[model samples]
Target: MVEKKFTIESSQGLHARPASVLVNHVTNFEGDVMVHYNGQSINLKSIMGIMGLAISQGAEIKVTAEGEKEEEIMESLEDVLKEQELVKN
Candidate 1:
């Protein structure tokens, strides 16, 4: 598995739209992916699971992925989230 810790920069954090975006991204892959927030972990491919976390701005989250191609997926997901949040590389 690969993991990355990042802060949610969006004012609304991972809400409906962002959550759906994240879920869609993860679902596009063949491996398993999850996002950990506030000590709770949720499947990255499931919007409902992510929404349950109710993340907010400044919240720290750990993104992880496992299975074949997990390393690539985890790195890409981290980059995507940073892009979505307008974070610098």
Candidate 2:
């Protein structure tokens, strides 16, 4: 299992565009990937699940992955977050 925390830094927060990008990115991985925020956890590959959270700027979120490629998945997710400018430096 691998886990990492990040603070949302995008002015628009984790809105539709970034949320779609995130979901699309994780869908390629084999295993379970989840995002936790505001005491709730949801599958990272579900666009509705992520957007439903209404995660705004400054919200701290925890991402976790478990399975054979957990580490790689986490690294990929971190890169996506940074590339999208959705996480703080």
The candidate that wins on TM-score is 2
Best by lDDT: 2
lDDT of each: 0.80, 0.94
Question: TM-score of model 1 relative to the true fold?
Answer: 0.88
Model 1 C-alpha RMSD to native: 1.5
lDDT of 1 by residue, 42-83 (tens): 888888888899888888888888899998898778777776
Give all TM-scores, in the order shown.
Answer: 0.88, 0.97
- Could you give the C-alpha RMSD of every candidate to the true structure, in order shown? 1.5, 0.8
lDDT per residue for candidate 2 within 25-52, as digits (tens), equals: 9999999999999999999989999999
**Candidate 2 off by > 4 Å:** none
Residue 49 CA displacement from its true place in model 1, Å: 0.8
